[model samples]
Target: MSTEIIYQTLAILLGFAGLIWSADRFVASSASIAKNLGMSTMTIGLTIVSLGTSAPEVLVALSASLSDSGSLAMGNALGSNVANIALVLAITAIVAPIPIAKQLFKMEAPFLVGVTALLGLFIFNGELSRLEGLILLLLIPVFLWLVSRTQTGVEQEEIERSEGFKTFAWFIVSLAILIGSANTLVWGAKGVALTLGVSELLIGLTIVAVGTSLPELAASVASALKGHHDIALGNIIGSNIFNIIAVASIPGVVGPLAIDPDILSRDYYVMAGLTALLVIACALTLKRRGSKLGRSFGVVMLSSFCAYYYFLV
Candidate 1:
């Protein structure tokens, strides 16, 4: 490998590490600050924590948009959704079957499909306009509200409170690191894409997408192992919704983004198919009591993920 390629690869690796660490700290600091301000744990979770989990994708999209690589940003959004289901959720289910509450199937899962369909509509014209971006952004509050309603009367999570100055300092520092790391990852990804003669969209779809999705993978798998099936499935569904509405809007909001035809023709189909499969799996196993996505379904999901990657290459 060329020295330049090596440096770029290092940058990508380091960037991913920094992003994961800093994003975690940023969320912790934010939670601490919110708790200090007397915000309820559920409120902080539904809003700040939810957004925090997607911080890498949001920042990466922002950096890619500013650099005029909107296709990469779009790919990050779509590809992250694919990875969340086919890879992260798949692996989690393999570790432990994810149980689905009938309520989640009736509500959150359908909401994700709706959001995905909305994204498809916006990008169908071959571009995402600034107006469409604004529309997506405006829906965030609605999404949060809906999610808050679902969590009504749920147990409150215990949060740790830190000193005000320390919390603020960490928040600022982590935010700065998040931005810088996102830029570094974008630069490195673009460099690698150029070096390999591959499109930035593909790099975003594969490498950057998976890297940014590390948080979800970890959270979901850990939650599943601990028998928090709702959290595991909920994490994936929520992240995918956020990606469609929030992270995907960055490029369009920054400037009009011309989406590649392949996004709709190929990637979108893959994402949508997996999403439908998730709902179908739940419906097939749906019991009046609950639905379980068993090890068999997980194997199918993993196989589909491999097939999708093969198709991509």
Candidate 2:
């Protein structure tokens, strides 16, 4: 490759690494700080923790948006949802079948579908106005209210466990790194796309998108292996909701976003289909501790993801 491309390649690699680590630290510290300030476990779980896991995506979207890469911003939001479900959860299920938390099918899963449908309807007009962006942002509180009701039994231990190795100073440092690296990630992605004559949507869908999704892959697989099925599936469902509603709106909030009809026609459809599949899988195996997702389901999900990636490529 050319010298500039090599440098950009390094930036993307380092950016991914920094983002994963720093986002982890940021989440931990932020949660710990809130806990120290006497915030209730359910409140922290529903708000800060959800925002923490999704921090990389929101930051990436903001970075891409401010950099005038609106397509990248939109692509990252849609692409991350696709990866979170089809790829991340698929691999998690393959490693260990994720059990169905009865509550998952009852609330969060359906809420996610509703939010995804809302996103679909917004883009149906072939554009998302600033007014639409504000509407999406306003819906976050409604989501939080829904989460609070469902998470009424959210345990203190779950919140503590999610916060790993908390460090207040390191949180600030990592927060800075996360912001800086997000810009780096976006710049490198745009550079590589330009050099290869690839569209920003393609670059965002393939490389940049997957890189940001690394956090979900790590968290979900770890949760599944540990038998914390709620955290495992909940992480994917919650993050996808956050990505669709919050992260996707940043481009328009920052500036005018040109709607890509391909998103409505293709990528978002892949997201919607996988989401419906998740709901069906949960409904079929509704037992709380049952293997709603076994190796067979894993194979199917993974196959679907592979086909999606193939289509993208």
lDDT of candidate 1 at residue 59, scale 0 to 100: 80
lDDT of 1 by residue, 1-313 (tens): 8899889988888877877677566656756776687654444433554465577798889888999999989999999999988898889888898766656664677888898888889999898999999899888888888867776555433567699999989977876776567557757876877776887889889877877786677556655664445556766777888898899998999989998989979998898888888888877777535557878888988899899889887
Candidate 2 colliding pairs, count? 0
Weakest ten-residue segment in model 1 by summed lDDT: 40-49
What TM-score should be assigned to candidate 1? 0.79
Residue 18 in candidate 2, Cα distance off native in Å: 5.1
TM-score of each: 0.79, 0.81
State the lDDT of candidate 2 residue by residue for 1-313, as single tens digits: 6899989989888877777667555555555654565454334433554565677788878878999988888999999888888888889888988766565655677788888898888888888778878788888888888877776655433345333344567656866776567557767876887777888888878777776676666556655654455556767777888997789988878876878878888998888998899888877877545446777878898898889888777
Candidate 1, lDDT over the whole model: 0.77
Off by over 4 Å in 1: 11-49, 155-190, 288-291
